[model samples]
Target: MSKPLGKILSEGKTKKVRETENSDVALLEFKDSITVLDGEKMDVLRGKAVINAHISAYFLEILEKKGVPTHYIEFVEPNMMKVKNLEMLPVEIVCRNIAAGHLVKNYPIKEGTLLNPPVVEFYLKDDARHDPMLNEDHFLILGLASRGEVKKIKEITLKTNRILSDALKAKGLTLVDFKIEVGRGTDGKIYVGDEINGDSMRIWEVGTDKILDKDVYRKGGTMEQVLNTYIQLYQKLLGKMPPIRGTKNE
Candidate 1:
């Protein structure tokens, strides 16, 4: 919202990466659009970009404070953040603390089962291929990541899970499961990249089955309903809310 950014570097279902003046930096612009089922379904909701921009930044900021490496730099008002440029890994690291979705669907595990020590898994980020799950060998053999890189990412991913889970628990939300993308930074270190908003994770009200994340959208909830849950999450997680549009702040 300052001077305009350069051409778009890359784009996806819910965000865009734009070139920045600094070669080592990228301007991440959040989109109002939300998608699921590997983008088989999509919708745009007003104010979604702003909500996700702040929510994801808040989560990554928490991770950075707890000694996790990340690409987060500074958030731009409305719907953008500045972040370190890096070579992104073509895989997603998922950590599940509660059995749900694919965890229960693909296996004999029951939904809502609390996974002890949690379950960490990897999947190739190929939407055309339905993002098939991958093991360390598949990751290595395909030259996606080295064995040591895999081990290192698992450490970071689990640590991220604990950090985020505890943070949400204090706000009376359950951290069900989440997916994250990693990238090698200019410093030659692995840094969590992409975004970590509700769209990339699941949340349920503590002690109840009330859903507070994107599952509502995937399960046929209306746009207004989907955003209401996300707004509730922002209020509880950050203890603050952006001023309502058409207000003084607007």
Candidate 2:
């Protein structure tokens, strides 16, 4: 049986975390609201949440199967899932592969240039501050995470990148770059938390560099175009396209 959803614990642009009867468990509900420019630009894409729930579940499950610890517990049909109620950090870990997005904008590195060894960066999850990048010393000085925790987090993150990169490559997609959130669980262990869907990652088609992820929306693609890309990517990667519960596909 499933636990009853409780009051809102927190909400972000595309998801909401709800409390549950079990203190260590929480309900994560996906929101159809999609935003770009750090929530400045937004729109409601019906059924977006439902499909991303599936996308995130699919990827996180892969990580779990490969022995990666995660807060994802179980996926609930439609729009919600159960997850470990962790003491989530206000940080985001970004791993870059081919240069694009901010990498190109912030640095002289040309877009699409391959990053040797793949740069992994830490960032403070502050929207108002534009989620400023943090160095290892910054992490320790600001008490964002302990030294050991930071080391472990980076190890896990890099390993996750390898696991996911290979997985997507097998499907003819390139893992351009992605960000993930980590939290300390009640078990005193760090875990990969938050959703790992197209929203959190840049996935491009290999040879043609066709957009197969949220860049479709981020770069000004229309709702129908973006949704179509998400749907097609799901079916392409997972090989099945069930009718999404909240969209016309249903």
- Residue 215 miss distance in model 2 (angstroms): 1.0
Highest TM-score: which candidate?
1
Q: Provide TM-scores for the models.
A: 0.96, 0.95
In order, the Cα lDDT scores of the candidates are 0.89, 0.89
* Candidate 1 residue lDDT tens string, 130-209: 99999989987899888888899999999999999999988898899999999998777899999998888999998886
Candidate 2 — which residues are off by over 4 angstroms? 1-4, 245-249
**Runs with alpha carbons beyond 4 Å of true place in candidate 1:** 243-250
Count backbone overlaps in model 2: 0
Provide the global lDDT of candidate 2 against the true structure. 0.89
Candidate 2 per-residue C-alpha lDDT over 190-241 given as tens digits, one digit per residue, 9 for 90 to 100: 9999989888899988889998888999889989999898887888787877
